[model samples]
Target: MYGFEIEGGFTFYKFRDFDGSLSLSDDHLKWFWEKMGKAGQISVVFYDGSVESFEDFKKLAKLKDQHFFLGFKDGRPAGMFWLNGFTQRSCFVHLTIIPDFHGKAALQMGRGVLRHLLSVTDVSGSYILDCVKGLIPVMNSLACRMAQRSGFEKAGVIQKAVYLAAEDKSVDAAIFCAVRNNEVKVSE
Candidate 1:
């Protein structure tokens, strides 16, 4: 089990049985992709208007700028959390929770991951996440709401920020962000 105490002395735990293991190794890359594909959920859309295949996803995950983690629940693949375009100031967070673990469980796991990111990593600026408005409900809406509950606030909307293959068009995205210091206001 892994754990950390966030602000206010609240401790969060990522158990091997409940929250599963999180790792950046290639050993679980394929397994993670398989689980994501099976969920019929596409967490990200490339700029080229193509959804990444398992191979391409693995390659992208292996990139130096990206941090990928696969979570296993009860010794099986359960969820994934990724940080793309990481820099000293900020990064984009992408999360996917298999349908089987959707709802409250997914929200708990997501909060745990976000708390870990904020408290454990060297990321002291901000953490941002974008989600296509239309897909929010179907694609883990609870997790999106949990972000706000965890101190992230809605920043703004980006028109045509993502290409949805299923719809064959670009869609508006809702941007949310959490800043490390309360003094730094999110720009309008």
Candidate 2:
């Protein structure tokens, strides 16, 4: 039961019962978008502003500085995790789990993906997560809490940094970051 205690003393366990795996190539794009669509039901308002049509998602997926991964549970598509701003020293981490697996399972998937990203990948320095300040109860707020629990510290706020399509405008964003070094004890 590989796990870590996050804020609120909640323990997120890594799912071992299923054949969980992560695909880093574009081969899983179709399956990845399918899960993204389902996860968007909860995540759209917080981050994406609106659900991306399959065609639109395809285009976004091809954008520069973005890397996508599809996580499988029992050999089935279960979640999506991606890194943005990868060309720079710091990158953005984003994740979503399908609606069916929202609680412990989702956290488990997130932990697994994050663990892989921080440990096995060369993309290191600091990882940033920006959340819209207004979408508190919906997205950014929860993410802020989670970031702290996961050992990320509040960096600062970037005014009008994010554009919410739903509002068709820009909004303030709070940034959180996790820096990796030999001294940082990142849970495995």
Candidate 3:
């Protein structure tokens, strides 16, 4: 039962004490989706399909075969992370925070979520995080730096085609992979 409270308890909490198979009802998922849609500050990067749709949420939720929900805050879905491709010894983390919760203070919350996720899982050998290129530049930088600081090395980048909002058609998306020190744990 590890958790941290911030802002004198105004409206943010980071929790990490549950297994990967955490569940949420349909109502909460829909509510958070609607809130994210309306919030101009929030932008979902992996938008190839109807990510905000309940079907997508259900898919991601049940993906606990190698993932888990970190927890929620202020009744809004805070963040969800998972480890994909277990045999590949890789874990991918996705974060969706309600716009109202995005700020300098939220960095700790994000770090806490990552730390908690990394701490709980065996990790097999290495972890891979696929995120939008330079998305939320400051935060992304922080996350990368944090991952490195936590003893993960930047393996390299894998470019994949994806649609860019600024562009009409799909383009190469840089996927960054960071690996822990042990090579036996992750495959090249």
Candidate 4:
């Protein structure tokens, strides 16, 4: 039932179930795969930054250092977030938001998700996170702007940091960094 209620009086994201558990399941993964499959582009990261086919997604999803989680809106898959490169205080974040989600609500949802993920504590009550990073493809200007609005600030751009399967070329990635702080507002 955890969701973001925007100005229009509608919820833009719903990641939790009635029992307060995040609705993470094979169904979510399947939904993500179908979306990526339809787009004809692979969204999973490669260890060597080489482009790989969809066949590798399931196998690579088990990579020890990385994990994926799904977010929802109105009981439908809204986005998938890949959290990787975890260290004591930081991790890399990658995202694939549903193309249909548009406008201010999408931006608000991004902000809320980032803030919630970074600020949340586990049952043990420990704070093992200090920062989260985004290496967004430079061509995706909307994502870059969304990151800025979501508490992530520009770090720098890395050349050929991401492989664009659709374009069949490597693209520059815009580095965005968000440190753990109380200033990340969950809503406007």
Candidate 5:
């Protein structure tokens, strides 16, 4: 894992701040919110098409779950990503790689993060990833593909669930579940 390298000749450093409150500051929070608007890696649309304040980000970060932030070589806040429902059984994520590092070494950091999430986090059964059908770029990342390569199948699509973002706009989303439990598989 230490020998892994990314496209821009940069190596990934694991940020252990799972609580998401360590490196964050007023300025950094503001930066995350501002950057969210132009972040191409994110598919979910924001209420105002802009993340102009850190309050919203802080709230999101406050969720009691496992989170990870990937940093670049120069350490200039390349990207911010995290996961929810992180438990010994399974975990989920709302990831974004930030636009600037879309095709650079920062992407490697994102992949590494996902790999860590899968390897370290004990998904009691197997790691499950939920993604929207329209967000192909995200679903096609190395992490998701790796899960498929590992024999994780498309369990099913989440049919019911209306996500209400800011402004009370309910959004429709699809969910994908993967179970790596041999016992469950054999039972089925």
Candidate 6:
């Protein structure tokens, strides 16, 4: 409700407070695809090992139950995320702090943005969500650690859950969760 929604954005979910938003015009979409296809970025997020074309990236971006947002700080892009499998109360999240901001303020931003997300309310004046989940590749220890620092708890692991394109194989995924009144503990 605080952020200005533009022509190419998810108006309901935009947040200016934490400086994260989704504005998906064609040109901006192209920028997202190009940035996400970077060697470091692609390895963690894409199962195809690459986004071969803008079309492919577009399809993924517009996939059912998936919403993407770019994080910003001082008007500069800082990170990005995919919110997947969104239901009335739960969703799966994949987040990445840009390489430049890595190890700098990952924990602070992650916790703040996530807590704010949990506090978002729908037009009906009800809390929109109660939980957010992270399904991370087991090999990505850094991500796992960051999730913990962001107040997520290790829930479990799913076998052969994530297919890494670069690895050309399926890898186990570690599940992490932050519940609104529990782990996340959002307050007024």
TM match of model 1 to true structure:
0.66
lDDT of 4 by residue, 1-188 (tens): 44444332334333334354554544556676777666643544332334254446644554555565565666666666667798887898876666656567567557766775677575798765778888888877877888887678889999999877656788898999887864663323
Which prediction has more favorable lDDT, 1 or 5? 1
In terms of TM-score, the best-performing candidate is 6
Give the whole-model CA lDDT for all candidates, comma-separated: 0.55, 0.51, 0.44, 0.64, 0.44, 0.67
Over 33-109, each residue of candidate 1 has an lDDT whose tens digit, in order, gives 66766776654433333446776876676556655666666657666666665555567776676677666666556
In candidate 3 the C-alpha lDDT for residue 38 amounts to 75
Cα lDDT tens digits, model 5, 106-161, are 44554454444444422475444322121112324453443333234444444324
The TM-score-based order of candidates, best leading, equals 6, 4, 1, 2, 3, 5
Lowest-sum lDDT 10-residue window in model 2: 129-138
Task: Give per-residue CA lDDT, model 6, range 35-56, as digits (tens).
Answer: 6666357656665465656787
Q: Model 5: residues >4 Å from true position, as ranges? A: 1-21, 39-52, 66-70, 104-107, 121-153, 164-172, 177-188
The weakest ten consecutive residues by lDDT in model 1 span: 129-138
Q: Write the per-residue lDDT of candidate 2 for residues 1-188, one digit (tens) a residue.
A: 33334232233333221233322334456666666565554345335444456666555555554455555565566665556655344567766556666656655665455444455432474443222111222236655555444445566777887777777777787676555442333332
Superposed Cα deviation of residue 185, candidate 6 (Å):
7.4
- How much lDDT does candidate 3 score? 0.44
In model 4, the runs with Cα more than 4 Å from the true position are 1-25, 39-54, 165-170, 185-188
In candidate 3, which residue pairs get closer than 3 Å at backbone N, Cα or C atoms, i.e. clash?
125-185
Clashing pairs for predicted structure model 5, backbone only: 88-124, 89-123, 89-124
- Which candidate wins on lDDT? 6
- Residue pairs in candidate 6 whose N, alpha carbon or C atoms collide under 3 angstroms: none
lDDT of 4 at 48: 36
